[model samples]
Target: MKARFTPALFAHAEAVLGQLLRFDHPADAVVSRYFREHRQLGHADRAFVAETVFAVLRRGRSIEARCAGQLSDRRRLLATLALVRGWSQRELAPVLKASEEEWLAAAKAMPEAELPPAVRCDLPEWLYARLEQQFGADETLALARAMNQSAPLDLRVNTLKADRETVLAKLAADDITAAPGALSPLAVRLRDKPALAKHPLFLDGAFEVQDEGSQLLGFLLEPKRGEMVVDFCAGAGGKTLLLGALMRNTGRLYAFDVSDKRLVNLKPRLARSGLSNVHPGRIEHERDQKIKRLAGKADRVLVDAPCSGLGTLRRNPDLKWRQNETSVTELTVKQASILEAAATLVRPGGRLVYATCSLLSAENDAIVGAFLDKHPEFTLLPASAVLARQGIACDGDVLRLLPHKHNTDGFFAAALERKA
Candidate 1:
């Protein structure tokens, strides 16, 4: 006999939750594998299971603590639906037992302060402490709140294919309503999530789903046509495509990454994008001889270094729980090494831009500061001036975006020019 309570879905959720609790693999990877294993789930069912499981992981600590040490997968799921998802007891009753109802009632009455700091903020303690150092009490609270919310899908119209107006018009023709992004000229903020994979415009490469904040990074690079540009950490070529577009497909854009897998993924995107200027290469590591060949040869280099990805909390809430102080410190070392290696690729008079998705000063300001101190040939250029030169007016010497301030992912960028 078929089990009660959406057996297939419940089983999927249970398996996913078990994997998530183990924390051995990325949540997305686990979810993807689950979907691949069970190909029968439709889009809506997949979304529901994925969202529900992520909700539990995002708020697992609080839920587990509320269970009074009697934590089981089923009880946690019921509590997650009730407390985190705000589902009514009657609504959850179908999936839960009468005994579970009493447990939930007791859990509902538990005081908030009794839970751990990680549970309180829905983040790991180490992450909470790190953020606490960067953000004051009120700001930390605000950031945590913002991170808990879902991110809207934003798309950047490939200018080479279509302008914002044309893209918007095309989308409207398909009965999709989109508004201009607050920050990026090429961006369109969709009112709701619409499947665009097979949309004629998307299939024709008119637009790509990218965060507005990320789109701004391409503008910050401001590559001129026919210039030699290098995206030193071009994982999957998200920014590489933008830089290629900015160069108007006339420049030699070298997209370098340490991971061959990421480089392979960029190939299809390159074809769909109609960009002819990009050259994707896999480096053995940052110090590869292939990288040395380009030393002082690039007119522009972007070190979009690997980071903690704290800025993307809205999209990956699980990160706040998975990240810790030790992991961040390790990342800082990698960032410094990558920046040092990438800086060598910039020619005298070239621009080297350092950027990260982290909001922490250690990863942002401190990394740049130490690099500037070690390299006298490189001097800081006002990012505002750089953007202004390109006719893009934004705030100050470094681009700092916050979820609360910019309604986008927290991003930090600084530009340095090699002394002529």
Candidate 2:
């Protein structure tokens, strides 16, 4: 049944939350499929379902703690709607019984400061400890608060097709309240989240739905026209298309990945992007002979390596429970291997950019540090200097964009050059 405003909506939210709680699949994917199967649900109803489910995810740990061990997917969902949504006793009277209402009152009345650190922060203890080792308690708490909220919708103007000023004026003319991004010249942050999938500008490929922080990584790579570049882990070619456009479609921009399925999705994006220089190719691994042919020849290489993805908690709150120290430890090893292989393709004096959406030191600095230790031929370049040269102002030898600090999804990027 389609989700309606009555008790069915509550039941529907619990059903979707049940699937997402298992952590078998991504929350967004499950939610998308649920809506697809029941297309009768309107836009407002969908938003209510999605927002409520995501709120439960964002505040799950604290809610569980508040429930005093009396919790189910349903109670957790209801309590989140009550405590976080500030639904009153009378407001919840429709769906909740008197006992449940009394329990909710107790949960809301509990003093949060008395709760354990993990519960108070709504983070796994292991994850909290890992972050606290670097960020300390106060800073980690601040970052957690920022990550717990919803992320802003940011769009990157495809400069090859549309300028920022023109896109901003057009959005204003359309009554979409938007302003230029603080960090990236190509960014336009929407004041409100509005669906643009069917908009004329989107149809014409005027912009790509990219995070403002993500747009900085392309600038860090800064591939020039006619230069050879590679997006080593080009999943769906998000950055690959941007790099091709940056080159003005003049260079051979190779998008390499192990999954042909993801590379296949790049086809439509490439067409919509109107770029002909990008080659979407699948390789067995970084050691594939096809990649060897470009060894020591490409002008720039980007290793947007996979990681624990904890930095994107605002978008994927389930990641906190899905990832652990063991998983992250294993990922660090894989990241090191990928970085080493990607580095081999950077010619003498060519640039190599190692980046991740992870904020962990083990995934970011440790991986880059190990690579620098093993490969003595590469020298670290000040990422800030590179951005400044391109007229993008950001400070840091290693670019660290944080949700609390930058209001952008957490991202880390390092620039290194092969010694001539």
User: Cα lDDT for residue 249, model 2?
Assistant: 91
Worst 10 residues of 1 by lDDT: 1-10
Question: How would you encode candidate 1's per-residue C-alpha lDDT over 14-47 as one tens digit per residue?
Answer: 7788887787877888889988998987777777
CA lDDT for candidate 2: 0.90
Q: For candidate 2, give the lDDT of residue 259.
A: 96
- The models' CA-based lDDT, in order, is 0.85, 0.90
Best by TM-score: 2
Which residue segments of model 1 deviate by more than 4 Å? 1-7, 111-118, 388-393
The local lDDT score (0 to 100) that residue 99 gets in candidate 1 is 68
Flag regions of model 2 displaced more than 4 Å.
1-4
Best by lDDT: 2
